[model samples]
Target: MSAAAIESPVPESVLKVEKQNKGTVDALYKGLSDGGDMGKVAKLIASDLEWWFHGPPRCQHMMRMLTGESSHTKFRFEPRCIEVVGDCVIAEGWEGAQVYWVHVWTLKDNVITQFREYFNTWLTVKDISPHGCEIRHENHNHTLWRSHPGDLFKRSLPGLILGI
Candidate 1:
């Protein structure tokens, strides 16, 4: 997000709301990157904000940042692309040909109401309606597709790993 996320002479069209929401998200990130008070950004987030993380619980660092519990003095987010799709802002982060993260943020009335984070893998947005939220994922396997015996050599191959 950047200050350029918003236009000064706002357009009076269907996209007006989206621009405002983008502006809000941009400001939030700006504040974080500038080491400014996050309390101001909190206003841009809904009181009942819904947050979900796909992957392991190793995402505690991000949770700390969001909750103002981190000791780091500065934060930086270099997004390769940020776009508004419907009511969500999708940010794809990459370095060279390798993508490291995908952030999906759902905003309503210029406030962030929901967020989903996918790290080190392709993002998958699953629609889980309230009525169908009871599905247990305890048996889910993160490496099933890539961990077959036939792929052992592939897994053993040397490779440079990078994480965001």
Candidate 2:
């Protein structure tokens, strides 16, 4: 009924990974759900924080947005898992979320510093900017999710290996 009354956003896929990943998913869930000290979490971030981006939704930007320290944004993330591989965490969540998108986070030194995101491309453009430009491209089409396509686990593996 109310925000506080609502359940946490952690997903089942993540729970499965928590057992093998040294509580990776669980620790992350605690950090995200409780809004704990992310500075300590920075140790998990991979050095080669990567993403498919030219601007905005980059990992640093996303962290700032998530940590509620960014001046540019006014929304907070309520994360839920789509999957996990090694150290890479892939999730579909809300950003104050009016829509769902898959975010893949790479952990290095115990902190998250790099990431890639996939969502309804239409929503991506809409949320980032109403007027699309050369730099801005529509990514999430919903067809993939609707059609049962793509290997999120395989996709996340490269980054996870790189991170570890």
- Each model's lDDT comes to 0.56, 0.43
Colliding pairs, model 1: none
lDDT of 1: 0.56
Going through the candidates in order, what is the number of backbone clashes in each? 0, 18
- Per-residue error for 42 in candidate 2, Å, reads 0.6
Question: Relative to the unseen true structure, what is the C-alpha lDDT of residue 164 in candidate 2, on a scale of 0 to 100?
Answer: 22
Model 1 residue 26 distance off true place after TM-score fit, in angstroms: 1.1
Candidate 2: stretches off by over 4 Å: 1-22, 54-61, 66-73, 85-88, 95-97, 106-114, 122-164
lDDT of 1 at 50: 93
- What would the TM-scores of all predictions be? 0.61, 0.42
> CA shift at 162, candidate 1, in angstroms?
24
Minimum summed lDDT over a 10-residue window in model 2 is located at 155-164
